[model samples]
Target: MKLCTLVNKDCSKAAVLFNSKKRILEYISELAHQQLPDVSKHVILDALMTREKLGSTGIGKGIAIPHGRLQGIEQILAMVLVSEQPIAFEAIDKQPVDIFVAFIVPEGNNEEHLKTLAAIAEKLQDKSFCKQLRHAKTDQELYAVIQGDDNG
Candidate 1:
């Protein structure tokens, strides 16, 4: 599925608001809970933190895609956050990450989860896309950029 299909306008947040990984993860968990009421925020945060233990998800060029899976969730939920200032994420490229696209999927849905991950990673790798996202000044602009149909 496309990133646009997973994240809508409501899931987009201002870059100036999120300045740390903690706030970013909290925002993602809250977004997930909106979709899956029974999903525990602590559970999602735990899973994400465990994944981070493996390594930072930052893929460079001002992007980070943090993901995790859990048993309680029935489907996948996503959140897109942009930071006005890049935050230290210990990215593989050794660059701070400013854009975060987080995903939480069901434990057994590995195939779909990976598919979504691949889509997100591949798309964000484009330099032009990163520039577009950086230029986005509002939630509407960011949502359009994430949707890959920016008219402004």
Candidate 2:
């Protein structure tokens, strides 16, 4: 599973100005609704919030990956967002998060979902790559950074 396979140029956002996790999730919900209109925004938010209750998706290093499973979806959907300022995310490292990658996957596809999560994690582990992502000035630049050759 590749980041480009799940996220497109249009799904990438740069310099998102949200102050809280709830607000970020709201934006993510809106993106999910745009991609999966048949799935209710409430359902998307509920699933993501429920997952968060179990543990924070903020994996540290100024990054967070919030993901959820939905029943009606046939395939995985993803969105990438970069904040203008870091937001407190209750991450394990106790650092604020500035980069967010949200995932919505079809229910019962645990194998693929985990693979995708691992892939994203691996890609984000590169400090230089993350720096480029943070420096991206526009959505197109952000998308290019995410879809760059280093992702593999």
Candidate 3:
């Protein structure tokens, strides 16, 4: 359950501009749709929104892991975005979010889903890693950071 396995250069973004959490979610949905053409964008958005209502995915310290389970997905898919500015996400710490590590997992696979979520959370807990992700200037740089290569 490595971030590198779930995310790639195409799914990673840098310096994205969005005004609110909803807008950021929309962007994530769009990226998910592109990666998974078989799944509709609306379905992805609906699933994510439903999960958000249950609890804010915004973990804290300018980081968020918005995730949801969806039908028709065989495995976990991920997208990462670094916002140009922090946006309110109703996180536990009541802090704004600037880094989004979103995931779409197959429905009913609770075990793998939780495992992957925990793995991503563990990686994001590192303040320096989050800082490097925020400062990434390009999609390639962002992917490099996620792969634990700060030299990029």
Candidate 4:
């Protein structure tokens, strides 16, 4: 249930230009499509959007964890995106968000989903870790920061 284990270099991006939450979700859907070609990007977007509709995933402090549960997925899919600038996300704290960690999980495994989300949330809660993420210059650096590589 580690965030680093859930996210890989290819699935992660740094300093992306996402002006809106919709664009961020679309990018995440594309990433998911790349990993799971059989699953439609539209379906992926729908799942993520549905959760957003219930409430903003924006956990404040410039972070958002947009997640969804879907059938036909054997394992969890995660993608990370750091925006070039903060974007309005309607966060509960009423602050803008820049860091996005999106997840697509198997619909039946609620326990796994919660544990994975908790792990991700815990990691992001670290101010120093988030500072490293925001300072990452490239995808590799971003992935490294997620992996806690200080030199990255």
Candidate 5:
């Protein structure tokens, strides 16, 4: 599935000032609650943190794709966050990350999860696309950019 399809406008945020990986994760967990209110923020945070124990999601070049799977979610839930300042995330490249795109998917849908992860991995590698995202000054503009609107 398309990354845009998994993302909802209300679930995204822009220019967040969180300065650490844990804080960013926590914020996105809260953001995820906005999309799937039935799920607990603590649960969401736990899932993401559990994944992090295996490896850092930080992909380098100032961007990170932090995703996890949840038991109750039927479809993928995504939230994008751009920090006003870069934060340390134990990236493979050992660089701080400034952009984060977090996802939570159904626990049984490993195929969907991998496909979505690959799609975003390829898309986010585009410097132009990331530049547009970073340039977005507000949540509406960020959503527009993720949705491929030129005005963003």
Candidate 6:
């Protein structure tokens, strides 16, 4: 599925002011609450914290995708944030992270999670796409970039 489809205008945020992973996860978890009402902030935090224990989700460059598998979740939920200041996430490339996409998927939906991660990673690799995302002036602009439609 397209990122814009999963991360709609309601959950997408631009120029998010966060300085650390804790704050970022808190912010994204709040957004996820809009999609999954049953998912408490603490639950999201635990998932993220647990995922970090495994390894840093910061794949490369200025991007980070933190994901977790939860037991009670029935569907996949995503939250995208563009930070006002890049956080010092221990990324694979050892660069600080400015763009983040956090995902919470059902425990049994491993394949779906992989597919979504692949799609997100592929899209993020495009220089133009990353530039547009970084330069986006508003949440809607960011959504347009994720949609990959200039005319939208």
> Best candidate per lDDT, number?
2
Each model's backbone clash number: 1, 0, 0, 0, 0, 0
Task: Please state the error at residue 57 of candidate 5 in Å.
Answer: 0.4
TM-score of 3: 0.95
**Model 6 segments beyond 4 Å from truth?**
149-152
Better of 5 and 6 by TM-score: 5
lDDT of 3 by residue, 38-130 (tens): 989999999899999999999988889999889888978999999998999999899999999999999999988998898889888877888
Against the reference, the lDDT scores of all candidates come to: 0.80, 0.90, 0.89, 0.88, 0.87, 0.82
Error of 2 at 116 (Å): 1.0
lDDT of 3 at 150: 31
Give a tens-digit lDDT track for model 6, residues 35-94: 888778778778888999999999988999998788897878887788878898999999
Clashing pairs in 5: none
TM-score of 1: 0.88
Q: Write the per-residue lDDT of candidate 4 for residues 7-120, one digit (tens) a residue.
A: 878888999997888988898998898998999999999999999999999999999999988899899999889998999999989999999989999999988889888878
- As a whole number from 0 to 100, the lDDT of residue 17 in candidate 5 is 97
| Candidate 3 runs further than 4 Å off | 149-152
Clashing pairs in 2: none
On lDDT, who's better, 1 or 2? 2
Ranking by lDDT: 2, 3, 4, 5, 6, 1
Number of colliding residue pairs in model 6: 0
User: For candidate 1, lDDT tens digit of each residue in 65-101?
Assistant: 9888889667677778788899878788988888888
Off by over 4 Å in 2: none
Q: Which candidate is the best by TM-score?
A: 2
**Model 5 agreement with the true structure over 1-152: per-residue lDDT tens digits:** 66677777897688999878999999989889878899999999999999999999999999899988899778888888888899999999999998898898899888878988988888888889899889999999998888873322
RMSD of 1: 2.6
